[model samples]
Target: MRLSLLDRSRTRAGRPDAAALEATVARAEHAERVGYDRFWVAEHHAVPGIASGTPAVLLAAIGARTSRIRIGSGGVMLPLHQPLVVAEQFLVLDALHPGRVDLGLGRSVGFTPPVRRALRRDVEAAESFEDDLDELRGYLDGTGPVTARPATGRVVPTHLLATGRGIEVAARHGLPVVVGGPVLDSDELPDLLRRYRRDFRPHRDSTPWVTISLDVTVADDDATARDLALPEAWALAVSRQTGEFPPLEPKEAIRGAERPAQVRRRVDASLDRAVAGGPATVRRRLDALADRTGADELMASTSTYDREALLASDRSLRDLVA
Candidate 1:
């Protein structure tokens, strides 16, 4: 399986959010130097913890800084914007960088009701995702009713950042699917993926491909690796309790802080799901995951407050997979 990185440009406590964007570009440069196959960013609107909201703009910045690494949106939420505009934005990115762009789409409307209103989207907006995806593809392939400009004849590969139903959508469209989170632990996952491959209908030579994404952190020892995973897990736990995701705090700070029993349990559960350990430990877990899911690629969507440790983790994960 190939290796890739997905950076959400997570904000850190006590720092300007804009700094996270710069850090994302630097990390992409490092990912390229270390031979990562692809570098993807995410779209998260009006989220305090995440700095990136517009993936295409951030991807443009990343593409200008790195030469060879494949730069893409780990996804742009299809329900939040017009399909033609999304197509044109990525088309422009492809024109500047040429073959290195990818467009990963998702159906998430927003993080909260207010966010949804701000984007002029409601829960119902997601219902049109399939139709929008078809329309967007038409523009990318030069088959839409109105052609999207900066039309470079090149097709920017589209991937679905999918869940259960989204996987079926991808299968119907013959596109690659990226799955993670609770779905990875589901008993029905293997069957779902098998069905996806079996049911896939080819679209212009497209084939069914699956990329498993998760938080994979590596350090010199098991304890140290888990420590690196703590910030992200804590942030997740807090979000579940408080309904707001905050900037990542230092691991030591997270460890020393007080927490309610429920939050503690959630944190422990999140840690249990993450693949974090020394080289041999992570390798064994990844092998099991690959065997279970028949994953074609591993997109390590890891994050932490300490930038240097995160970089070391990225390099270590690349070596583990390569």
Candidate 2:
């Protein structure tokens, strides 16, 4: 199976935010060295834990640093930007990087109510995502009402970051679907994907594709790998209670802090959902996931406070799946 990465440019508790972007670029370089197929970044506006709010801007930097591996968003939220503008940004990326660019679009709005208001988007704005995706595809394919600039007649591959409803949109548009979160655990997942493949309409030779994304961390042992995953899991747990996702704290710091029972339970649940262990353990779980979903690719969205450890996990994951 194809192995890819989704780096969110996660910030650390004590480091400057700029460091996270630099770290993301450094991680992309490492991903190429480790034989990863694609090194994708994410967009998370006004979130304290995530330094990258703009995928295109960060992708340009990543492209300049690496030549072989594909670099793209994992993804850019369509509800917050004009379809034409989004097309232009990615068209420019394709202009510079050529065949190495992929456009992964998601329908997520801003992180919080304040962030949504800041972006001038309400919950209802997401209702336009399907239309926006259709319009965006038109611009990308040079069939829109007006041509998007730098339209070099190159088609940048678009993948939809999807759940059930989003998967239906992808099928209707004949685009690949990237699935994660609750849908992956649902008992109805097989039926959902079967329907997606069955209903997919062909657009410009497009075919049904599925990519499964989730957090994956590897280390010398199961305990160590789970420790590396703790920071991200804790950040997620805290976000639920406080509604603000903070920077990744050291695992030591997380363990040292006092927490309420609710926070502890949330943290345990988050960890349980993540795939983190020794090589054998991770491979077993991943193989089971692949058999269950028939996924075409595995996109690991793993992060840790220790940069070296994160890089090691990336290399180990590549070795396991390559």
Candidate 3:
């Protein structure tokens, strides 16, 4: 399977956002050296742990630092921005990077009520995602209601960060999809993936390409790997309980922190869904998931408190997968 990187640009508990962003660029360069297919950055708003609020800006930096690996937004939330501006930003990336840019879009709202209000986006805003996608597609296809300048003339491959209705929308539009989260690790996801493939209708000269993405960290042993994976799992867990995604803390800190019973359950659930182990263990789990879903690529989203250890896990996973 093709391998790629999906960076959240995560901030450690004490580190500044700039450090996390620099880590992203450094990690992307490392990923390219280690034979990763593409490097996709995320977009998150008001999440202290995730510093990637503007994917286009982050991607431009990543693109400037890496010459070989494809770089793009793991997604730009389509409902959050105007179609024309989104198209133009990506087209600018295309102009700068030539044939090595990917445009992945998602339909998601800000993480909190205040954040949503700040964006002037409500939960209902998601309903217009389809319309926004059509406009973005039109711009890329050179049939937009208004010109998007260089974007109208240049071609950029697009993918959808999807699940549920999002998958159907992507299938209808014939865009490739990246699916992950706990759903991918479960038995039910294969059915959804199969249905997407069966229903997919190519929008142009294209075929469906599915990239399975989830948290992964491989170390010399199972315990160590799980340790490296703890930061991300803890972040997800707290996000569920407190309704805010926080930064990564050391594994020891997380293990000792006091959480309410319900929060503990959520934390355990978050930990359970991720794949973390030694090389052989990770490979086996990844192989099963890919085989079951027929994934074309593996987009790994791994982060931890120690940057060096995280990079080590990445290198180990890279060699093992390769």
Candidate 4:
């Protein structure tokens, strides 16, 4: 049960400003020292709450500050960018960091229709994701005719971040694949893993790797842990329902506010899926999830408000899992 960090640098107080950038960078540096296996950031365009909308650029900065540990996107939304550009950008990252880069690709749009259109994505673009993925692979492998100079002949391990049918494509290509959020049944995961492992045709390696990301937050006491984690859980639920990034409010504050019963129900539902408690409780839950999923790696994204609480959760996780 290797642990990694998934950062969104979500704005908690109100507006996302320069303070968030400094805090995120500091947190990344702290994560490196605290023995996190990897620090992966996400990309979300035009989202007011998420500061890491340009993960490649943030990753470059992170790579510069940290001496070791992997730095990469949890995924770059491939449908929104040109594959060649992605290849070139990541080629530079690999050149700078060498054996410390992981390229994760996701097929979905990270933004809504208006923002997607602003980024030049259309309905037809979604269908072209597989083509773009193949082209990116070819470009990186040096087999494509339009040779990406720095990337040519350079093979960086690529992972496909998938939600549904894209998992099969990832397995067929023999790339590592990541499954994220609200996994309904444990049985379905092993079946997906079996399909990936069975059908995988490795291009660079003989075996395929599978990683899963989940929401996790730990504290010394169970009540305190839940208290710290509730805000982001509520925010995620609201975002899913509304497709808009709302201002962050403390859990108690939100609960006190006048809101619909259905909205409260959604927030409670989000908390059910998230792992939050004392270290012992969290460890037991994680071990069970790993046992059920058979995931090679488990990455945790904490939605705690206090930075110290977040760091404590990371340390507690490493110690418990170790």
Candidate 5:
């Protein structure tokens, strides 16, 4: 399986968001240098912890720094913006970095009610994702009412960050599918993938493609690896309970603080699912996972409190699989 990255540019406890974004560009260069397949950025709004609210802008910055690696949105929420505008943004990106741009689209709504209002979008906006995609496609292909400038007749290959319904959409359009998160940690993903492949229509570009994304942290030893992952794990659990994704606390602070029993359960549940360990152990786990899932690609969506440890894990994965 090929390795790719999905960076959210996570903000740590003591760091400013500016640094988190700069770190993303640096990581993109490093990913290119280390031979990663693609460098993808995420989009998250109204969250202090995530800095990648504008993937198109971030991809432009990434495109400026790296020459060979593929740059893309891990996904743009199609429901949040005008289809014509979104198409033009990516088309312009293609102008800057032709043949190296990918457009990954999703149907997710805002993180909260206020965020939903801020986007001028309803919660059920995703119910119209197919229509949005069609319009976007028409604009990119120069088949829409008005020609989308700078990208007329130019095609940007698309991928769908899919669930059950999203998978069907991709199949109909002959596009690839990016699947990740809790789905990767479960027993259900393999069957779902199998079903997708079985049901895919034979469109010109439609072959079954599945890229699994998950949190992976590696260290010289299992204990330290888990230690590195503690902060983000805690942040995620806290988000579950509070409905707000907070900045990542330092691992030492996370270890020193006290927590409720419920928080502990959430953390344990997360850590149990995340891939955290020393090299050989991680290699074994990753291999077994791919073998069972038949994953064509692995999107290593890893984050940690310490930037150095996080980058080191990013670099180390290649040798383990080599």
Candidate 6:
């Protein structure tokens, strides 16, 4: 039942204005004080609505402001960057924060056609993920010498954010993995967890950790929870359908937009993945999901308009973990 904050820093209109950045940092600070185990920022590029295009830099900022809470990417989109550079960036983070860093890597490009072309990533590049992961490990383990001095002898554990065969790669490397999204059900995740546990070998220790991030929102009532979650749900749906990132609008506004029927379907599906309700209802859902999946840790990402309501959602999660 360990809890953490997952921030996307979504702006309402593709603008990460000064106010949004300030609010995000403040939220991270509040999360640390309120007993969150970690603060994970997502990496998205060329997405005007998301402020966290460079998660490593943002994590460094968050790390400097907080003492105990772990700070790292919810995941770094691996296909977009060189593994060595990523290793070095995180190596410095480990050097500064010691045991308080987590590096979660994901294989998805997370961008549209033009952006993917701009990044110069071919479809085959994703296949190199296994090689890149090994190279990163080699750099960290002191076996690779070129540009590897920073991370050598470091104990920073790396986790893979996987949906498919990437899970097997994580198991092979003996790293913890996080499985997410709507295609994953409570029943499916436990089997993956078992596979990881059975296959894991100790890079430095005998056992591996498993964590999952779920879209969640807790409010004083179910109606309010749904209301707060609409923006996030809509944005996710739009992203999925168009392969583009856009700022969220009110549900009523969305209904008025010239959206395709398929887009509406996608949005509905996104809403289904989100758990939104009062504290008691949310706790019941979470406990059921936990029992079903046996997830080692549960991280929550929320989208609420009001600062107070957002903080309340976080506080509710803290109480549930307690």
**Best prediction by lDDT:** 1
Q: For candidate 2, what's the RMSD?
A: 0.9
Question: Which ranges in model 1 have alpha carbons more than 4 Å from their true place?
Answer: none
> How do the residues 1-322 of candidate 5 rate in per-residue lDDT, one tens digit apiece?
9889999999988888999999999999999998998999999997989988999999999999999999999899999989989988999999999889999998889888899998888888988888889898888777888888795355887889985667677777767899876666666777787877887776444588888888878889988888888888899999988888988888779878889899999998888788999998788889898888788888888898788888899988866765
Per-residue alpha-carbon lDDT of model 2 for 1-322, expressed as tens digits?
7999999999999999999999999999999998999999999999999999999999999999999999989999999999999999999999999899999999998767999999999988899988998899999999999999898778999999987788898899999999988888899988889899999998999999999999999999999999999999999989999989999999889989998899999988888889999999999999999889899999999999999999999999999997
For every model shown, the clashing-pair count is 0, 0, 0, 0, 0, 0
lDDT of 4 at 11: 70
TM-score of each: 0.99, 0.98, 0.96, 0.94, 0.96, 0.90
What TM-score does prediction 2 earn? 0.98
Question: Considering only N, C-alpha and C atoms within 3 Å, which residue pairs clash in candidate 3?
Answer: none
Model 1 alpha-carbon miss at residue 136, Å = 0.4
Q: How many Å off is the CA of 126 in candidate 5?
A: 0.9
* Cα-lDDT of candidate 1: 0.95
| Best-fitting candidate, scored by TM-score | 1
Off by over 4 Å in 6: 147-153, 240-242, 250-265
How high is the lDDT of residue 203 in model 5? 48
User: What are the per-residue Cα lDDT tens digits for candidate 3 across 230-316?
Assistant: 778778878887778899999889889987788777767766678899888888998887778888999988888999998888889
Residue range with the least summed lDDT across 10 consecutive positions in model 3: 180-189
Please say which candidate is ahead in TM-score: 1 or 2.
1
Give candidate 5's TM-score.
Answer: 0.96
